[model samples]
Target: MTSVSQRPAPTPRQLTRTSDRLSFIYLERCTVHREANAITAQDAEGTTHIPSATIGTLLLGPGTRVTHQAMSVLGETGAAVCWVGEHGVRYYASGRALSRSSALMEAQARQWANPRQRLAVARDMYRMRFPDEDPTSLTRQELLGREGRRVKDCYRAQAARTGVPWRGRRYSPGDFTAGDTVNQSITAAAQCMYGIAHAVVTSLACSPALGFVHSGHELSFVLDIADLYKTEIGIPLAFDIAAESDEDPGPRTRRALRDRINEISLLNRCVDDIKRLLIPEATARAAAETDRDVVTLQTDGGHHIASGINYDDHENATW
Candidate 1:
């Protein structure tokens, strides 16, 4: 006689709400503390509790101090940590990806390893920026040259639209004061893009080192993905902010970019674009599996997390 059996349902963890999944938290001069499931920032004024579940990435800006306990909690929450500088934001470190599977990363590596596939991916990216045109036959150098020309034109157009002075894009990594307000604004906008790109890439369990367009850097893929949206959003955003009065453009630019990001629902768009670019077939399968709710949930000390990198929103996603 055959017997029928049913598996027990997975228990949901009692994690805190993220309050609409606010993506970025920029802090300075405030000490970070973790109590229970909440993260807080303390200063002379008072204490501000940051909801860890909704925090995508925490920026440790200048003059901020963080304790080991706080770091431990953030790791558990699966939040990405970035150490920042003036012009550009370099990724200092991060916790483990919410997804436990490396299938997406492996697929990325496979495509990146093949020269033809790499070029094809590059063409796909170019097409993303220039959807009306075809770039399938273009060589890598030709593609790069065309992209550069498009960016120059984009800068000029945005400058004209926003009434900002065009003094060319000049930026020295170490020299923060190297350019005008426009330059500063552009730098701030680009930094935000890079951070978002890093978050999405890591969240998908992909390696930022295996880049199709850029190479030989830790954030090569970050640069590649971030550059894809430069014309569509970043350039116009910087130009608009630069058009504002010339006082303190850095914070203003980042805040405005954040607003635009929210307005256009950019996070979900990013996840979709990354899936479309990396592994379409596998992504489709994952989406199907997720729809069927066949995911494997893992519990680390009774804290539940989704088991694989996601195409759609993860069921037990950490953050």
Candidate 2:
């Protein structure tokens, strides 16, 4: 048997793609450890082995304990690990991304650095959420107003459809039970969406804090991406779950949302949407196709030269 240190780490191309993996696997009250490349979850009933490479995100809910070997395999396999609260309502921490390339990260930074470009991206985000409406000329205030109205309308519509009593949205952080069954479902779904979106964003190596629309928060970009599907997916599904039964709405919503995510191939769509929003279509395609682990030296006038060769004799060389 090979030692852990002697095991070869899989390259980016060797690992499973974010778009083709399991949406998420939520576990609680289990002791997670590793056996070869598979992570085993042991509980009172029995132990179950999960292929580490095929998992998009591992949501460790309350009472779940993970060993270092499990985490090592998960990181090696490029599977995101998220420590979430009960019913996956709160997100505490996350693991590294799968991507080895910085193409998308650079594009996000370039678009976020300029005020005009940032606003343009914000408008584009709004357009994505509401494809039928045009937002090219809307200011930030107007955009916020429109978003608020649309969300309110969605709530009313879902309520009407589900026949769940409609009251104003009420939610307080750290208090999952503060709201009614519908609101709890919505909150649960939103948190799950955040976890999923966060996994995809990080898998693509995009900065979660550098959001075009949301600002100041560490998960601003994650929030922005998750909101893109709220009205269409999260809200409606939350209502459906609540309408079914209020018992364990949080867990119920999470399971239902996972099914919906898989049914719609949401992970694939999210990866494509993120790339489209940050980079040109041609560049996005090129970046996705590039599997090289390359390094370069940046010189004056935005030029990049091949790395590893010293230019000590040249006076014009900056490095």
Candidate 3:
């Protein structure tokens, strides 16, 4: 019997999340209907066509009814669907992210499986939140305490800056009218942050349930990633909008968040941060690959192949 040569594995498709297609649209009280290759929102104001190809995330807040066809189109275009409550209090569910790559997911699991390695990853995330504080020697509880103090300080600082009366963070899930203006604004901005964070996390092919700091919940990882930006993006915007005393803070906060995100290039930053925070081994592995000596083959136009596999560039096979 003749021996069989192994067939090469087919290249995995790329679900590229573009930097240009980064608008995290927030919609409420509208009907999302699929209109032939496009998505549109039908409400009292009339039909407004949405550019689905470039939409990163669509926050379907209260009263937003999305048709099955619209969801199918969104899934096809790789746009994340986030179902949130009014003022973003209830993060009920989210649709799938577009990435088909499993490399990052495997790396994240391997790291978390080991006790020492898991702690190291946690410290790395903590460092991102507190660059000044050395997380190298801190335990998990210590990190939690520090983060708690930091969040309190952020609320106080923002309240002082905006001159908004702050009683504290008090809210019942799905009860948007229960909280004061400041609380409502904070909740609104935070929902936007969570929605954007989910898009970035899913784009990287990371697990939302596997988180370093926040754990044991569906949105554990989403919350962990979102917290990294509370001081910089979330709290500041809430304070600014509340300070303005806008007659309608909910819509205004959402608009301001979208603008602020674009202005600061927050989507790109979120994507980069997720990779750096979760799969740092990728950097080291890349360095190791570059350090190895490449072997040249006379066939295939004198192909010079590296020594290891690169999931990011599967077509340029190495291993």
Query: 27-70 in candidate 3: lDDT tens per residue?
Result: 88999998765799999989999877678888888899998878
Per-residue error at 239 for model 2, in Å?
0.4
List candidate 3 segments past 4 Å from native.
1-18, 284-319
**Per-residue lDDT of candidate 1, residues 89-196 (tens digit):** 444665554344565676789889999999998999999998977998999999999999999999999988888889799887767667898888888888888887
- lDDT of every model, 2 decimals: 0.76, 0.91, 0.76
Task: Report clashes for each candidate as comma-separated counts.
Answer: 1, 0, 0
lDDT tens digits, residue span 1-319, model 2 = 7789688898887989999999999999999999989999999999999999989999998899999999999999989999998777778999999997887888899999999999999999899999999999999999999999999999999999989998989998889999999999999999989999999999988999999999999999999999999999999999999999979998899899999999999999999888888875646357564345677878888888888988776756564
Q: Model 1, residue 296: what's the lDDT?
A: 54
Best by TM-score: 2
RMSD values, in order shown: 10.0, 1.7, 9.2
Deviation in angstroms for 216 in model 3? 0.8
Model 1's alpha-carbon lDDT is 0.76
Considering TM-score, where higher is better, how would the candidates rank from best to worst? 2, 1, 3
What TM-score does candidate 2 get on C-alpha atoms? Answer: 0.96
The best candidate in terms of lDDT = 2
Cα-based TM-score, every candidate: 0.83, 0.96, 0.81
CA lDDT, candidate 3, residue 68: 86
Q: Give stretches of model 2 more than 4 Å off.
A: 281-285, 289-291, 313-319
